[model samples]
Target: MPFIIGTPIPDNKILVQSVSHIYGIGLSKSKMLCQRAGFGDDSRGLNVTPHKSKFLENLMDKSNLLLGADLRRFQNDKIRKLYTIMTYRGLRHKKGLPVRGQRTHTNAKKRAHFNTNVS
Candidate 1:
């Protein structure tokens, strides 16, 4: 393949290390996105090709996955929407809790207290 200058290659490492390059993407979520994108969990960033880069960008756009350049836009939108819906429901959404019909009894982070002052 001809060397494409300036384009990045997406593989396991990049997915794991710096997938935040995409909009709405973060470390934990990026791993899941990469998994769903079929790049495996341990892929490297340098291995990504121009085609993969295009695929990733398209995938992120289509699925609301975060990537390069416009991440803050999504963050701001999410924050704004969260505030607009502010209520127990809005707080739930902001905290990433189960909103629709998921059980939280098994894992309630908010219910549990983390006291740094105890130290």
Candidate 2:
């Protein structure tokens, strides 16, 4: 059986890489999660017994880390806040341009391109 985290089921393979499939869990965090769950980095997800899998599930539930839909909602809320504030970044996002001060002269031509088609 596959290990389900949030909406995704991780395939039975390297434990660290499997865990990293969930949102907000990077390589380092996945490694730490594997260590915390008493599994070796190379341990296969399929090899995890029900008891160990339950423990891991509980650990994930208790952690502050966001996953799947929750992570998406959180990010959307952040962007919404930025838009509401009308800050410089918000303006850039509103305009569909690069928010981080990238040169718009040439590199951001894709973003700067306007739809020429008229109804």
Top candidate (lDDT): 2
User: Residue by residue across 2-119, what tens digits does model 1's lDDT show?
Assistant: 1212224344334555565444456776676567667776667766666776666566667753445466777678767875877665565555665565677776555324423321
Model 1 segments more than 4 A misplaced: 1-14, 21-23, 65-68, 71-119
Write the residue-wise lDDT of candidate 2 on 2-92 in tens digits. 5546534455568778778887778888788779999986798677777887887778878877776788899989988998998988777
RMSD of 1: 8.7
Segments in model 2 whose C-alpha atoms lie over 4 Å from true places = 1-3, 111-119
lDDT, model 1, position 15: 58
Clashing pairs in 2: none
